[model samples]
Target: MQSWQKVQCGVLLSISIAVMAGCSASSPYRDRAEDYRHAEPSHYELPPIPGQRDQMPIPQGSTQGYTGDEFIAPRPESMQTGVAERPPVELRKDNQGPWLWVNTGPAKVWPALQRFAEEKNLDVVYTNPRSGELMVRADVGGTPAQRFSLRQGVGRQTSEVRIVSMSSGQALPFSEFDRERMMALEQYLLVTQQQQNGRVSLAAQNLDDGDQVRWVDRDGRRLLVLDFAFDRSWGELQNLLSNGFDEDAQRLDDQDRSQGIFYIHYLARAERDSGFWSWLFGSDNADKAKAYRLVLTPSGDMTELHVEDASGQPADIQVEQELLDWIRRQLT
Candidate 1:
């Protein structure tokens, strides 16, 4: 009976093993796991989102691509050459003196001022177009007749007429009378008759349009060259920042005239957007404004201006050019 029991146990154990092997061979989870590991996406394509487009393929040898990148570059330097449109004629004053900035060259300004003196019935004491100076005797309010000086050809195709009141050979302060005289001349120059007259003064032809502010390229880097002493250059730039440019106000963050560094916040007109959405959101211009350092170095009598970042590090070439151009336009 014991032998029969052992044979029966062996048969039962073999049958149990066969049943377990059959269950393992037909297991659903075992086969499904392999399919899950090797699964791929469906063949159908989804519609693209509105206002979205696929990025272009990168160039073969390019190490990086800017497409689809949020980075906006500085406006490229204007390649269009030739004289830019002259700034509108305006009246400017500073510690030096009040002067009328005429947009035309000395040739036109000299003749126009001569006509002004004649029309006003003012006594002309001296006239030297070559030196860009004209002295006229005019009464200032109740004061005696003072010597008014009109200087032409101050900058590039520009003129400055300054009235100097000399009492006992001592220069007096410019009064409202002087300003009225300048305003009259400014209006005279703007008239279509005067501008279309084409009467170029032969004597003033020799008057040097003392181009005090200009651009120069040195060692492959562009610079704004001010043909003046360091002290004078500093004063000129300071006056510009103080007076501000056209519609945009120039902000002078910090300045060290002795060290020849001016830290300023600058915004280029090209970077500005006039769209309705841009104005409503105030997003475009706020991000475009940047701070830059203007470094001045004396080169003989001339002062050289170079643009750098706010930290004094070299700025991007395009940004430097734009800043320099802005300075040149204002100073000139």
Candidate 2:
């Protein structure tokens, strides 16, 4: 009976072990994956791609395979350029003066400003103390200073703007200040022909079937005087046209605005004539009709000026490259 019992126990133990091994073989690899699910990176930063407008793309070409296990890169400093890599831009003529005044301050602090100005071939003016008021005076000393003025106690603060003259008989051709100012300034162009309290009519509105004015430069180059051209009242300086010119030397076919026009009336002065320019002006110009004769000084410059002659009007004028080149030559 004891022997029979031992045989039964041994067979039962062997059968239990066989049953467990069969169950393990029946299960799949997925069961093992669920058991190991605790691993994770959570989040990480990625490198930029090359060939992008803002960044470099990776792998040289995404279509190709990677080398070894991963790729290597060179030091960033070795591939990068400096902050000053970009170049400076040119400014428009009207804004040039103000812009330069601003940049000049920083220029005094920075070595690069001086170097850059020299490289671009521009003139730089520096003053002691660099006070704003003194700078304004210096700016106007060489050019027509009164044309522009400083305004304070308005809106945001103080700044510069052009002032208008209100002397013309409620009429004006051109003024930095809009229409209202132009009307006021028409007199300031100040036609010596007619003067009441120093206000003068500069030109007459006479429209003969065929009559015109010419744009002559200091050098005597003739430019086509468009319909807009008219004999404005000669300013304090008769040689100076004062205002009422559309564009500068480049006005051939383009519609634009120029700084201002200065009518020298050089020939009118040289030829000793005045009536010619006045008649083309008009009868409304009845009060403002005076002739100016511009004579070259011994230094080869104008001493006295006159307009109109016993013969025809001032030589046909035109705004040409030679004209501007010549005028700037004489003025500066």
Name the best candidate (by lDDT). 1
How much lDDT does each candidate structure score? 0.68, 0.27
List, residue by residue over 64-134, the lDDT tens digit for candidate 1.
Answer: 22345466675554453223444546666656666666666777677877887788788788888877666
**Which of the numbered candidates is closest to the native, going by highest TM-score?**
1
The C-alpha local distance difference test score for the whole of candidate 2 amounts to 0.27
In angstroms, the error of model 1 at 264 is 2.5
Candidate 1 stretches greater than 4 Å from native: 1-88, 138-155, 192-195, 210-212, 217-221, 229-262, 266-285, 295-301, 329-332
lDDT of 1 at 54: 56
Question: Candidate 1, 33: how far from true, in Å?
Answer: 96
Tens digit of per-residue lDDT, candidate 2, span 1-332: 99999999999999998998887788674455665477675687888877557355464543222335544332222122211221121111122122111111121212222233355343344322222111111232342212222221011111122332223223223334333432332232222112222221111101111222233334333232322212111121222222211222111121112313233222111222235564565332223323222222111221222222214254322212223323322222
What total of clashing residue pairs does each candidate reach?
A: 0, 45
